[model samples]
Target: MTSQVEKRLAGLGLELPPDWTPRGQFLPFRKDGVLVYLSGQICEWAGEVTHTGPVADTPEGIAAAKEAAKICALNLIYRLREACEGDLDRVDVILRLGGFVNCHSGFPSSPAVINGATEVFIALFGDDGWHARTAVGVSGLPGNASVEVDAIVRLKD
Candidate 1:
């Protein structure tokens, strides 16, 4: 059966990726009690880094970085689904999100870029998706991807 979260994703014209394998020596997500901690996900799809290089502070750069951030969020959602045993409806709340934007030193638009991921969660989970977040510019990221995001989620009993 399709979960409500899946339906919401369809309504938003989005779908989770088919598969995601961690590229490093870490689990994609770790569960502790009712909380699931998701590792960072970059803007990679089908094994290809979609957005490489540091983001510039221009309109086009921000826009592209935003899209990259969205991709990262989708990937994180994929891991979240796995952690929830393929039932996203089991999610109680998105507790927090940590976003990193690969950009030049002192880039001021990291928050704007990370909003891409925040919007996705809100669209999919409504009030439950609202989360505390930290968005920061970084000199570099793994895979040289433009954006990466990690999450913490609470699960319903």
Candidate 2:
């Protein structure tokens, strides 16, 4: 069967980089029966973080960070599909998402910010895309990047 993850990536002109090892002895993903918990993924590509600094400090950068979050979600999908032997449809429920905005205390727009992933997930998975999500502002992100996101997806029967 054709992988929508692969085809969508091609349509979007992107390719998932290899799995990234977690910092401090942490693992990136853990599966229990039918659900997979993916550790938070930063908006970095090839070890290079696309942007940094708080949204209040960097407006244009914040806009870019929103776009980057969506891309990060796509990358997550690719990794999940690869792990499941190339069947994205086997992903029955993309149950939850947690997004981080590496921003200062005054920064706002978190819901719209996380909409980056929300929008993409819907486009990709249709009604199955609905998910519980958290959009949080933090003092800083692991790599000082402006955004990061993680997910929990329930595998199909």
Candidate 3:
């Protein structure tokens, strides 16, 4: 396999979760004319939930959710690239994303934390780096993970 994604992960010094799971019926991504719509994803490693509390807003929140968001971005890269047959270079735009942070009260910087994902996208995609996004503070999220992300990407055909 060509190493666009593996190289990206190695450059970041990160490992795949070995267990990121999709909680819903929808497929993780759908492609239509250079657009990839990613399903919502949470921090699951080996079918187990991590960051099992308020995301980025509590003392117990895993520092890794932010990191996980970065990882998720990597996962997104592979998702899109693989969908297009390893053509990440054909990626044209990030259409939208709904950022869900499962947090308790007093979560002051959820946006900042989610920026971990945002930064990774910018770094990886460069000019195709920005998207319409919503960062929401949710009472709870599936699997009780601290953060979850859903994205829509547009690419070159």
Write one digit per residue (lDDT tens) for candidate 2, span 26-134.
Answer: 6667888999898788777777777674655455665777887886786677567765767887888789999988887867777667788777787777788899999
lDDT of 3 by residue, 5-69 (tens): 35665676765454354667777688777678887777566677655656655434546667656
Candidate 1 clash total?
Answer: 0
Ranking by lDDT: 1, 2, 3
TM-scores of the models, in the order given: 0.98, 0.87, 0.80
Best by lDDT: 1
lDDT of 3: 0.68
Per-model CA lDDT versus the true structure: 0.94, 0.76, 0.68
Error of 2 at 141 (Å): 0.5
Cα lDDT, model 1, residue 126: 94
lDDT of 1 by residue, 36-101 (tens): 999999999988899986998999999999999999999999999999998999999999999999
Quantify how close model 1 is to the true structure by its C-alpha RMSD in Å: 0.7
Candidate 2, after superposition: displacement of residue 128 in Å?
A: 1.2
